[model samples]
Target: MGTSLQHHGAETSPPPVCRFAPSTTGPAHLGTLAAALLCWLDARSRGARLLLRLEDLDPDRCRPEHARSLLDDFTWLGLDWDEILAQRTLAAQHEAALDHLEARGALYPCDATREALRAIGRRAPDGGFAYDNRSRERPLPPGGWRACHEPIRVALPAGTFRPFDEGGLDLAQEPALAFGDPVVRRRDGAIAYQLAVVVDDAASGVTRIVRGRDIAPSTATQAALQTLLGLPAPVYRHHLLLLEARGGKLAKTHLAPRGAALGLSAPRLCGQLAACVGLLPAPEDCTPTDLLRTFDWQRVTTIDRVVRWQDGQLDATPADP
Candidate 1:
């Protein structure tokens, strides 16, 4: 693992390596463009190498066409990365990390189904489910399987694996708070995102992570995994989400169709992205390069608002989108 340090003014430390990990489950959209652009700008400004990592570990959902489309989409947006990594090819590396955790007693087998979890949640008065630590220590139920486990017998650093508090940040506050011993390896014999990502980031020497605020909660989980695995934690920056007309974050699966109705020309899409982050010199006249030149981390607002674009109108949504 590599160290990431801050230097005094006029003194320079080695530039941190950054990475963009995108899931290839569907088509790339405006949010993807914005994230890639921000990451590229940040890496360029610091003279750092930017790597593109495809998060396609879930075999059922990921497709080659989706991966190819993601590459094409980023290229069209004028963003380039130093290296491309595919998660599927790195399964052994991630499996090793999971094995390491299991050996250290930091992970346990989880055999709970989605339906069971939903029932647990419904039974709780607060509409949230809590795993009973005592019950979790027991054997699996008949027909029910292991769901999640804890690091009971492992020696860990003090203050590690603590509860995460979102405090209205719209991100997962902490891994333990929402999930206890969340499945590192699923029943289907697939590695979970939490485990795979940590191993990949560590192996790839990633030091900075920039993505949408929607995934900020997952950071806490990743942070805990890093500490347990003795890997360096990356600096995190969660950007605002791009929204749709119904006040929902635009997911790859739910994004507007690409063509006449959405008016999604590469140039036009890039211009809208620039304006979303308040990088417009004059919305109609700004080019991608112009926006890139002016882009700086300091200029990024902490506002977690939803960016919305419709029939020639752009605005922010008060609700989560």
Candidate 2:
């Protein structure tokens, strides 16, 4: 066994490939920019390919202007990626992947209403909602929620349900013990996030996922989907979120000064962004070239930090590293 393991370790490994997948629902703020910078530095230091993916699947919320703004912001930051992909452009591909999962009996149709799900969640004693798989065998009436656990089987097509912990915190036996079967496709035909993200990542050949810590739960669902689809899971690195002065995280909707308000050129903004993530010195004046030379990934903090916007000035303070 040791010899076999040694042989496997001796095999050549592929080059590291990382991606920054950001939703184009709003302007790219400091939080998103910090994640992008870290991914860029990590990939560049390892001589790996850095790809940018626009997650614009939420058509109702995503806007073309936001996408353009994101591109502009990244360009201003002096970050370059090898390839860029939009989720809307790959709808057919994602649909095809869904069809494959459906064919394998891995997914089922769900007709649960938002209110019904919320009611179920409220009824749970532990405050954690569990789907009753049996609800899939028997159709629920209008305004009903389908159960993903058994003893109350709901109507579902013939398929093999994969075991998942939903929370992704434990790998225990009795697949249904932790999480009940989650819905992959809604009755209205809208794909769930778990299904969409997994399909997209696999199809795009994303090997590493870099993002904020808030979406860690979604990552677990993606991991389960990878196993069901027989695809390799990507490495995940959750960076600290940038917070606002009100003790809330900085969001695109926050009324911060724009490019003109900051009175900063492209080179200046690039330098400031580098300093925000502790990549360069915190001097008042530094050129973009200086930042490029000093860019280092080791200095990035693992704990959430604050990017306070006070009186038109942006102050970045590192939290627990």
Candidate 3:
């Protein structure tokens, strides 16, 4: 890995490399479409290289069919990418990263179970149960940290860290207190999202990250990881999310309709997603290429949007014509 990038107050001059990383746990929904479109627009507008990365980290929920279907959805919606990658294919690199952290004495094996986490009863900013970093107090295995089969967590640096985001979002906080020391490796030996993403982005030389605002809360934690790993931090621009009216964000758990299941043509679905983020005046049938000329970060909405999936159609007030 390269040394930590110097922040000299000027953006990196290389043609930006951006990625649309989507988890393949389920079919692509409106929220997924919206995030994909925003990422495509941002990269295409700047004539940057865009990558489509399948985040199929969880073996339990992620399936091959879902990954194939997501690729089809992107193709149908006229979203093109310069390169593609699967997170699962890089397990060796993730393990190597863990090896690096362990060598630095920055990692510890954690045996805390989910039931024990619930017992602590602390809530994180993102509303999930916050880990109390109990593993920090435990001794490493007799052989070493890596000799254990338990989950591995990073010893996150202390003090508040305020990372810079191009979207003007406030990402200031102590990562350990905000989300606790994130698990870098699960007991099952799967590389956790936080560490995997930082390691992958650095290895791929990704310069910018454009995605939904819902991931904003995790930025500080990931930023801390980047610092510890001696990797370059990407410029971040979190776009608005397509949320369900009553249940919060549209997600696989909500059974939100996939782009194929939406019963709309490709251009029509692209238009609806574009309009939701202020890329278009209204939801008019169009391709991702059609909106590139007018795409501007300033035009994207910062507010979360409410959308409804009813009667075989998407009803988002902002996109309503």
- Which lDDT values do the candidates have, in the order given? 0.66, 0.62, 0.82
- Each prediction's TM-score versus the true structure: 0.78, 0.74, 0.90
Better of 1 and 3 by lDDT: 3
**Residue-wise lDDT of candidate 1 within 127-172, one digit each (tens)?**
3454322233443333322333422221222333432322234333
Ranking by lDDT: 3, 1, 2
Misplaced by over 4 Å in model 2 are 1-13, 122-134, 138-183, 186-188, 255-257, 281-296, 318-321
**Deviation of model 1 at 223, angstroms:** 1.4
| Model 1: residue 199 alpha-carbon error in angstroms | 0.9
| Range of the 10 consecutive residues with the lowest summed lDDT in candidate 2 | 149-158
Q: How many pairs of residues collide in model 3?
A: 0
Candidate 1: the clashing residue pairs are: 110-146, 110-147, 111-146, 111-147, 164-173, 164-174, 172-217, 249-321
Q: How many residue pairs clash in each candidate?
A: 8, 21, 0
Model 1 CA lDDT for position 279: 61
By TM-score, how accurate is candidate 1?
0.78
State residue 125's C-alpha deviation in candidate 3, in Å: 1.1
Deviating ranges (above 4 Å) for candidate 1? 1-12, 122-174, 256-261, 285-287, 304-309, 312-321
* lDDT at position 232, candidate 3: 90
- 1 against 2, candidate with superior lDDT: 1
Best by TM-score: 3
Candidate 3, residues 1-321, lDDT tens digits: the string is 889976778686779999989999998877887888888888998889988889999978899999998998788888889999998888777878887788778888888888888889998888888998877866667776568788889999888878778878898989888789999888876788999988888878899998777788898899998888888989898777777766478887554444455677888777877777777777898998889878887888777777876675556664221
Compared to the true structure, candidate 3 yields what TM-score? 0.90
